[model samples]
Target: LEFLQKPWHNGRLLRSKGYFWLASRHLEIGLLAQSGKQFQWDYVGRWWNFIEPSQWPRDEYRLQGIMAKWDSVVGDCRQELVFIGQGLDTRVLQRELDHCLLSAQEIAAGPLAWQALPAATAFDTEALSARPTPPMAVQPT
Candidate 1:
């Protein structure tokens, strides 16, 4: 929030939006959308890390596919946001967001300590469960 709320490039920000993982909620993905001075975050869903290998879709590529994007320690948790505006200083934006990331000591404390921090967004499993999971892409036999 501090990043978006602060005046940048003389208040030239037009839009910014993307998905990111918060240290506070390692399992859940956060979606950030900002236009001018307003922005809101929504829960996108859980990373494949939370989904047990046994529960993964039968599609053969499922495991191989996600592996390409996964990290040894954090699985697929990452910051992937884009900023757009006139006269935007990308270096400052990157530095600011990078500073917000968890440190080694913080990461070592693990999920329990991380979860103790306040969640950036709220999501109800009941509501999410009511929505159907999209069918997997068909693989050639």
Candidate 2:
């Protein structure tokens, strides 16, 4: 998984004046392994999305928040995400993501080669379920 923030021209931070233009200027990339009843594939292509936090309603649940609590194992295991935004250039995004996929040559190199690719930081899923719960205090009936 990868999270990317669109950098402003000259690398300036988005300012108040650019709020509307930059509100949804973020990208999420995911990679998922495919499985069938009796077989599993190495990896499958997934989609990307542009996210706009500003447009979400106050009470609406956002993937960012939900993702924060994701169990790394399962969360890190799938390549799936929703791009949230407005007026996004789907073509540009698609082209960029396509560049990240493994080429036929890379795929032929096998699992060891695939594992050598650079990857972003991922959540620690094993720790998710391993956390101990707080004990409940006794209460009057």
Candidate 3:
């Protein structure tokens, strides 16, 4: 809907640079909270870099104001915002929107790790075999 209201850039409406930057910050924080995976995927380090030590309270205000409250979980909406900030293309934009939306919902509900994705044993042989792997080392031909 936000995209529809304005020219589509990257699932974003192409606002000013500052707006996009702010949106990126918001989006990043939201993604971190939702996926239980921070941008750097740190154990103890800060996941959302935008919220500085002094900015924590400000974040709380923005979170409430921007996300529409715990019911909305604004923190989970950062990926789309960042994608827009970085200016992804149109199809990319829609795809991003779809993905970020799901991430947001997952975050809103609970942590992503707690939710089960199928384990290797849960799939058929081929499906299990599809697991990503490091490429075989090739020497001289």
Candidate 4:
């Protein structure tokens, strides 16, 4: 809701019968509620750089080698997001995000502690897909 309050905010938040998706850019930060019960935040900072098709390894073994070589971090679990907008307040945004990150103590607390966070409500996916679509009216000649 804080994001909607922004003066330059011009985007839509769509909620289907059983689906939720965000299609926005320019610092819109689209949020999606998975199955209306849980929010999937898996792709926070992980991304792949452009690699030429010709340069790509031909085999699985070679592919793994290339991935390891190019990726400084052994595992590809890092945050890397791009923000594009006019009159953007980068510092404020970064500071807010930094504050939300897990502290050293929190990280050490383990997954059990993290699971205690709030949960989302579940919705009926079948009902959403089975909903009827309106037919177009025929024009008279």
RMSD after Cα superposition, model 3: 15.2
Better of 2 and 3 by TM-score: 2
Candidate No. with top lDDT: 1
Give the Å error, residue 118, model 3: 7.3
Worst 10 residues of 3 by lDDT: 17-26
Two-way TM-score contest, 1 vs 3, winner? 1
TM-score of each: 0.70, 0.33, 0.24, 0.38
TM-score of 2: 0.33
Model 3 agreement with the true structure over 1-141: per-residue lDDT tens digits: 232234444433333211111221221221111211222210121222323435443556554553442223333223223332444466776664463233445445543432342321232233225544322211100
How accurate locally is residue 1 in candidate 2, as Cα lDDT from 0 to 100? 29
Model 4 misplaced regions, further than 4 Å:
1-74, 119-141
Expressed as tens digits, the lDDT of each residue in 1-141 for candidate 4 is 223234533222222122111111111111223332332321111112333346544788756654663455322222334444455566775775365455678667655664443321112122225443222211111
- RMSD, candidate 2, Å: 17.9
**Candidate 1 vs candidate 2, TM-score winner:** 1
Superposed on all Cα atoms, the candidates' RMSDs to the truth, in angstroms, are 5.9, 17.9, 15.2, 14.6
Instruction: Give the clashing residue pairs of candidate 2, or none.
Output: 31-79, 32-79, 49-83, 50-84, 51-84, 72-125, 73-125
Q: Which residue pairs clash within candidate 3?
A: 27-78, 28-78, 30-75, 30-76
